[model samples]
Target chain A: MNWDYLLSLFMGGLTRGSIYALIALGYTMVYGIITLINFAHGEIYMIGAFTALIAIGVLTLAGWNGTAILLIAAVAAVVYAAAYGWTLERIAYRPLRHAPRLSALISAIGMSLFLQNYVRMAQTANFLPFPNLIPEFAFLKPVAHIVRSSELVIYAVTALVMLLLTLLVRFTRMGKAMRATAQDRDMAMLSGVDVDRVISLTFVIGSAIAATGGVLIASHIGQINFYIGFLAGIKAFVAAVLGGIGSLPGAVLGGLVLGWTESFFTGYVSSDYEDVFAFLFLVGILIFRPSGLLGRKQMEKV
Target chain B: MKAEFKKSLLAALWFMFLTFPITVVRVNTIERTVAWRWERLIWIGAATFILSFIWRRLLHRKQTGRREVSAGEVRPPSRWKQMAADPRLKGLALSAAALCFLVIPLLFSWNKTILVTNALIYVVIALGLNIVVGLAGQLVLGYVAFFAVGAYSYALLNYHFAVGFWAALPMGAALAAAFGLLLGFPVLRLRGDYLAIVTLGFGEIIRIVLENWNALSFGPSGIDNIPPPGFFGLALTLRQTHIAIYYLMVALTLLTILVVHRLQHSRIGRSWEALREDETAAQAMGIDTTGAKLSAFALGACWAGMAGVVFAAKQKFINPGNFTIWESILVLCIVVLGGMGSIAGVVLAALVLVILPEALRVFADYRWLLFGALLVLMMVFRPGGLVNARRRAYAFEPSAPEKSERP
Candidate 1:
């Protein structure tokens, strides 16, 4: 029955799903708060990877240790990405808040294009080889064939992050404000919540999460390019939609579902049409279940 | 003013800090080398400092402008618009524009003629997109897929059989319209952002399939040596053929303008506009939102298909790369920047967008970067577009004061 092969594919899917979950978290959170797709969110992820690579290059040249370099690089990426996210919202979205939905969407698309070219021009157009920072663990030698050490690390990190996020969103006062703002911006504003601050904070947190995903995935893939964000962003958006956009847990579930779907399809069928399968699956879900798996359906107000 | 200066300085510093990692530091990981271009940081600081002032002023104006608009102040129309609206000036402008279009190819060089022809093609495509996005309010990001359908229909038909361009043109439009209807049927129920993503996915799906499906699309290498449109068995040289194609595009563009302008004034067009404004209201008014939306998609696709066939004939080659998401976005930009639902604006924007890059060959590298920034800026400052679409204003005659109400 080839249980081992299936198990490996499962683990691979799990790893991939966690990465998508990381990026999807950003998209879902932003969409939840603003109801805007935040098309530039993917570009934030790419920026995170680029920032991390720059940090790594500098730190390594200064004779820093591996662990310290990784830690500093990750922090740098997150902070820079958060800043980018904040500025992006202020510049591209803030003014369009009262405009038509189409205007904001077009603005977002424009921001995405601008950022892609910005990175491409700032960095080289060619693909950069990302250094593998995750070290091999000796404890998992026997079951190494089933899952690599990086996969285990990914699972643990994703779980820890998810737990922390859940705690923050559920237990904190700021989280309460964020939730209120997401529920209804005008109401929140009337209730004395700083809606603008909440929205900015939402962008910061989402971009930070996306940056973490960007760094981890770039390290895993061992390469970085300016165009990576577009496809990954779309796929993650799909994941966010699949689970029920605007729901955190839904994003994770959607990511896992999308991951498994792609992994299994690639494993059994020809890998050539793997992307087609994901898109077709999305089309199917959107047609049959427009609100997604966990999304609440709201009646249109006249 | 001093406070504004302080704010600008702070913004400049914040931007410098934000851009430090990417702009100031260049890292070559494989070689373990890092280059610090500190000058770039200075440039960023200077640029942001100056831009912040302009941005703040514009934002102030926009906020005040909104209030004035909501207060029902009748702002005077711009001179160009007023001239366009006046019958006497409008006729003069139209004749002048028509004369320029007719005489341009005859006087211009071959390359310039070709460039103008390309711009005309975009004018048609952008007008088509204007119908779907501007009129119907469906954000179709994969509009180029239909264009590809038309292009490939002509390419494959000519390659496989002895089908000529004249026969393939209508076939291409029909095929694309069918494809549009196919995509529109199920997706008509979805809302804005979801619809956008689905269309985008549809676009990528088409591109990927074309790239992988070697049996049909000839893979990524694409089909080459496509013969240009036949001229009734008249053998013309290469230059003459290009000139003829230019005239063909001119005629096609005028025809598209006529069709689009008529459609915009038609009953179905009003329905589309109503649906765009409010779906529930439109449906309650018995506008048949489904038919209006589907027709918008199909009609838009129909024009794109025609343009696609023309584009293929012009290039004398067909490739999947020609129909990327970027091309669709370019047309979208033309529609948006020109002012959605404005025919003259779309034509003007298409000409500017297509010809500007060709005119400024030195700034080719920064073309997309500038386009991206322009989009954001346009949305922020002028969402109404370069030339705002004028609503059909009917003269309202006020009734004389009644003697009974005078007391």
Candidate 2:
């Protein structure tokens, strides 16, 4: 047991988990409401990364520095990505709402393909470098030696986002509408909850959060590409499932656990088997608790 | 006429805009972002406009007034239906199809013969998948895993033990069946999306194993110089080999159709249909849900394995890349697009999916994009598929209804 090695892996896992948690939050929220996997969610994330790259490039020309530039770029990315998410829902999903679940899933998959190729065609298939924008934090050296400023930024941003999301869901009228709609669409409609608006809002918010994750991940990885969103999206979806899909806390927990599992597996076992192990874990979870770690066991209505 | 043209123009522009985000290239490596190709958009728009008018006049006129019967309903007799109803006409049509298929290579060049051969292979794959997803109502996302397993089994047996194609054929299928059982047991409780993902995971695991286990699979480089199957004891030249494989694929495809058609009429077939319709009701009526599910899995795997052996034999090489999720997605698309549980639909879909893409040639770069978009569009417009399988209109009634009626 190398304490130093373990500590580094743990820190690395935490940052990775934060990214997964961001993406998982979107997956869980959308799934909770409509029960569609939103296969395009990953592509949305990639688009976010690309948008951020373009934004940073423009901002850099405008001679902005440090946190101010990062903030503006991040906001720009989130807004653009939220718009993409909303459009996708409107075009691909809303039309197929009354259709079979398989239809929506297929639509999502199509949207994903469309978006991935769209980006690949628009942006170079080659990896574009993302700017490092986080300011140095001089005070964290004593508390955790392995923690870097950018990583610390990721942790803080993710925590802040989650807190804000929790507040939004708990306190806001729209949040209440979303929760009500998720609970029972018919009943919610009867109660004057605009289920349609709530679903759209869910997509909007989820995409925004996923965008934020995309920015952070791009910064962390120091590069962005068309293909980045897929594997990350899948792992995050698995995490969302692991935590019990449709549960916010479950998604976060699952993301963290999945991140840690990969890190530890990579550290202790063969690195080549990381994805294999993650997939196996997903299979195990599916076999044992199909509802997931915290998912409500659904009853088949006669 | 103007309205239709306007509609076509709008559709074309929409497609252009949809392709815009992916089509416009931006590279910042050395601060250069140039979007190449403006004329392609014009080509697309022009093509769509021209084709839309032709299709509207030629094809849409005939189908414009046909009643859209839901799946499982017995459609009213049409020209095709009337022709199909006559045994003499049906036999003649079948003979014509067989004859056409046989003479296709002779009429076309060698490239087309190979393409048709590949299309024939896809038909076999689609038919096998139809058994699980279409007939059994189980969506197995990792269906390609079985196909890959079959190919590997054939390849490895031949490579390691000098086992010829004849011996390896059954061996490959059996091994694939054994794997299907192994993977199917744990997922018996799962349904729909859950079953899909687990199967997908199972497929990925198998792929990873094949990729990593260098000694067995030769890793990513793939095994080459694989011996093609012989005609009993006769050796074949390259040209003759292509013809032999083509006919071999034809025989196998026909064999698959016969087996599947027969199975659909058997006692077990009825059980699968019941299981597919409503698992809970089927179980309540003592349908042995797990047994039906496993059998479907096994049988589907068996066919996929046989296809795999044929594919390996034809290619004379095997690689892990040949067995990717794309392959699974392709087969699944065929089953879904063709109309689940419709044998003729699967055959039609297999031809359309394989032949159209291969024939187009230029759209090869956008293959997955085209496939994915078509899948989504198909689902949206025709959820039941191109030829939706009707509810069992010719099958056994469960004893419950009969017992209640008697009482």
Interface RMSD of each: 1.0, 2.7
Query: What tens digits encode model 1's per-residue C-alpha lDDT throughout A112-141?
Result: 999999999988789998887888789989
Which stretches in model 2 have alpha-carbon errors above 4 Å?
A58-69, A136-145, B1-25, B31-80, B84-86, B390-407
lDDT of 2 by residue, B213-305 (tens): 888789988989889998877777898899989988999999999999999878888889888778999999989999999999999998899
* CAPRI verdict (incorrect, acceptable, medium, high) for model 1: high
| Candidate 2 overall lDDT versus native | 0.84
For candidate 1, the share of real interface contacts preserved is: 0.84
DockQ of 1: 0.83
Error of 2 at B48 (Å): 13
The weakest ten consecutive residues by lDDT in model 1 chain A span: A293-302
Pairs that collide, model 2: A118-B21, A118-B22, A121-B22, A122-B24, B72-B390, B72-B391
Q: What does the lDDT read for residue A94 in candidate 1?
A: 96
Q: Write the per-residue lDDT of candidate 2 for residues A79-152, one digit (tens) a residue.
A: 87888898789768986887666567767767887788767755667887887887666797674657778888
The C-alpha stretches of model 1 lying farther than 4 A from their native spots are B399-407
Q: Which number leads on TM-score?
A: 1
lDDT of 1 by residue, B1-407 (tens): 99999999999999999999998899776677889999999999999999999999999999998899999998888887677789998889888998999998778899999999999999989999999998888999999998899899999999999689999999989999999999999898887888888998898889989999999999999999889998989999999899999889999999999999999989988998998888989999988988998999999999999998988888988888888999988888898899988898999999999999999997678888888998899999998789888878897977777734654
